[model samples]
Target chain A: MRGRLRRGLLLLVLVGYAAIVVLAAWRHEIRPGWLDAPGAVARGLLAWAGIPPGVAVFTADSASAAEAKIVDLCLEVRVVEADGRVVRLHPDAGERCPAPQPRIWVKGEEIWLDRSAVSLRAAVAARRQELRRGQSARATRLLAEALAAHFRARAHAEGLAPERYALLWAESRVDTNTGERSERDVALMRWGPVGEGDLRVSWRPDASLLESHWPALETP
Target chain B: MSDGSSSYTGQGVLERWLLGPVSLQVMVLNRIVLGGVLFLHAASRAFELPRLYGEAGATWSPAYRAWVDAVLAPDLAAPLLALVAALAELSPEMREVVVIGLYTVLLGSSLAFASGLFTRGAGVVAVVLHMLFVTIHPFAHYGWASLVSPLVLYVVLSRAGDHLSIDAWRRRRRGLAPLPAEAPAWPMRLLQIHIAAMYFHTGFARIDDPLWLEGQALFEALARTLFTRFTFELHVWSPLLVLLTWAVFLLEPLAAIFLWVPRLRTLCALALIAMHVVLEILTNVGWWNFIMIAGLLAFLPPPWVARALPGPVPASR
Candidate 1:
């Protein structure tokens, strides 16, 4: 009787664990409403324990939509000296700004980005959604200010005096519908006379102010 | 209650398969490979902790904080938010120092875990620290990093250090006989189940998607500048990309099942490894392919692993 009880308990535990795994997998794939409570429990337990509950990998849904929509995103930064000289930060040859680059020195040759930059892009995009109605100018100014602050911090970390020069940050979105591939720059933020004081942002500045240095995408 | 008969014969078939004695070699391989992968991942981010997690960085935004709170459970999110709030009170220099200090401990513990010296303790520390860092700025992580914690936890729960470890070596030096090569197979079995579930979910989730079904998923992914390694005229190579996409579509769900069959295990493992290798070459996903390859090592036959690895011969079953 003792042996039988022990075996029964072991079987019960195994079955319980298996059920959890299967449930987690089912919730991840199917996402049925009835499973929400159990799924939440499973996700909470997994997150608390730092265990992966096994989710779907990349399905390229968003990327596919981006391609089909012909949307192009490029981030540009320019440093404007007090003497009226503007210096653009160029990405390495054969690479685009804001995309991850391979850091060969790291073990396993991992690809890396500032990551904070990517986060900033996401934050800007989310903020854009809220400011979409009539607050476009305000949204543009906010994006520019955020970009300027992030870049300033990066400069400080690299031992550069960010206050010594004004920073110009802008984003260019290509109008692929025009057939001629005309690009327009939305000058987000212009922080000048580099200082710790409140930044004066000018939104919807002249598009010609910031020259696009990014290479044009070749049509297939 | 002691019987002269072999104890293995008394158990049911399911019990025998799940709880039966198996060589500890597979577990040891898992511990080492997973540990090494963790170490490499941590080491790659060593210089960027300040920028990635500091107050002045992009992660400090109010929007991101709200996003984190929404994604994590309330119980888990509260402490993480509290910790971030506490860190917010620190000076910039001090915050950088604290972040670097935590990262150093994580890196060291990962090395120790991989080396199998104080394996369980080191593994726990590594997993906790990794999870903390991942939670703080999850945008920096990918699917590969998500898989690390559970895999390491499985390793820690097993008797992975029973053999082929510094602890085992020290025991032998103290005149203790080396442990038997065989141990309960449940932990490894659980790991196998986890991998299968992962494949099953990823595979079936794409089944009805028009992009994947029409073989345009890979093409679209490659066309995106963010993920692809090079700029090329992909339209010319669309046919080849479609073939690869279909290959993944078929093999993924099939491998999830065949991986359980003794005769088909090696074939599935090899096919999966080949797919990962191809992905590594075509894209710049960080450490994902390598981590998957490390997990695939568990599915390899014990005798094959024992022969390839340099160690005392595992006793025959």
Candidate 2:
């Protein structure tokens, strides 16, 4: 092909791509819409060709939406031991401890204490209710205090008191329909055991803080 | 007697600029690299076919439907979802078998593409299977995957297999000896344009974000040590983190434009590679950082590539 012809064709294709980007951005929001269509086209072609459907491909928007759904439903809780043998706070029966621990972590002098799974569930539920009520900041504070108490109680039960420990919170969501999983760090809180019913602590909800983690509860 | 050829001065500016002959070495390299990357990508998922794509997989009919409804237009979604629903009706065992078969085709075709054997046919099959994989699971999609999709399609239409390939070697063996080192530049140029647009858009999007503006994005990113390969304590390096943030903002747009400048092209490529390397080190973004760097390789001049890596050097036009 002549260079001029090729360049003209190239120009046409780029303009078309640009148009797609503009349309996608205008309709959906900021994401590059041009990128979304190929997978959709491929899936549509398969369906048209009567081929069996295959694995899923995510667009930015769809993945984010699915992520939001999962976050509302799943929480990943772990307790780190002093010797560095972390335990899964809620492991299904017959499930082995994952070879790799969750990326969500807390720094500073650390200790692990095991507590009642049932109590943690109740506390998480209470926090969820507060979140649904649009009291995200307050709920995060409460959750932090509850986690600190849970650790202190465990220390008391074991007849050992650690000078300090940190709580790592990671949230995960699984799609009910497809079993797709999405997870993110929720928060990390540092707490030091003090006198009875007293604790010194520093807590923050991820880096974006409570607003991003509890987007649903953000003030309109 | 009038000669057929016209004088160079008589040619229009567009003709002069767009019609200039360039080497196809970069295009051929791009073809091989993409084919290899995609083959490994497909092969890696072969064993997990049943769990990730079969009817019994997490992204079954309902999940596929939700995804289509969310991203695709109604006209496109209806047919696609119906097709998914039909496919989802297959028995678990049958779906598993189909998934395995599809991946096998993808692996073979991708290898063929990389080797430049049956180039056109292999390219077609590879692209088709790649798209199916994308449709299989909503959660599996990444930006790099989409970028590769168009690129593979475009290269399929070019003379990407003309050299540095099994096809070339076979032709030489068959008496079409010493294939020309330079092919047309249209395909590689198109790829360059696409890459520039991507960089521009990415940088443009970040221009307004408070986190990016305040140079706190990296600080926030640093705190998420779960994504890092090794522990990196950066509390005392806050100022440097802030400097790196602004550097990213400057480098992206600079790379996008200066990449076309022959004098600055090499530097731009290096800068982009460095940026991606940092991202790879600091975060678990999967194949994204790698693919983006690979995509940028399309911008490299053939002579530079020939000198830098082992391959057939470009022939003068």
- Candidate closest to the true structure, highest TM-score: 1
User: What is the CA-based DockQ of model 2?
Assistant: 0.05
Cα lDDT computed for each candidate against the true fold: 0.60, 0.58
The chain A TM-scores for the candidates, taken one by one, are 0.34, 0.38
Docking class of 2: incorrect
Interface RMSD, one decimal, each candidate: 16.1, 12.8
For residues B1-317, could you state the per-residue lDDT of candidate 1 as single tens digits?
12335444544656766776777777788888888888988888767866687765656554345334433423243344445655655676787788878888999999988888899999999988887777677657766777777788888988888777888888989999877878877777778888887787777756665556777567655543334565454656878999998999899888778888989999999899999998888887777887677677778777777875688848444
Give the top-scoring candidate (DockQ): 1
Instruction: Give per-model CA RMSD.
Output: 14.7, 12.5
How high is the lDDT of residue A65 in model 2? 49
Worst 10 residues of 1 chain B by lDDT: B70-79
Error of 1 at A183 (Å): 24
Predictions' DockQ, in order: 0.06, 0.05
Query: What lDDT tens digits, residue by residue, belong to model 2 across residues A150-204?
Result: 5554554465545545554444444556655654444556555445533345665
The residue-by-residue lDDT of candidate 2 on B59-145, one tens digit each, is 665544444443332323334345455566677677677767878899999999989998888998897777666655534655576
Q: What share of the true interface contacts does each candidate keep?
A: 0.07, 0.00
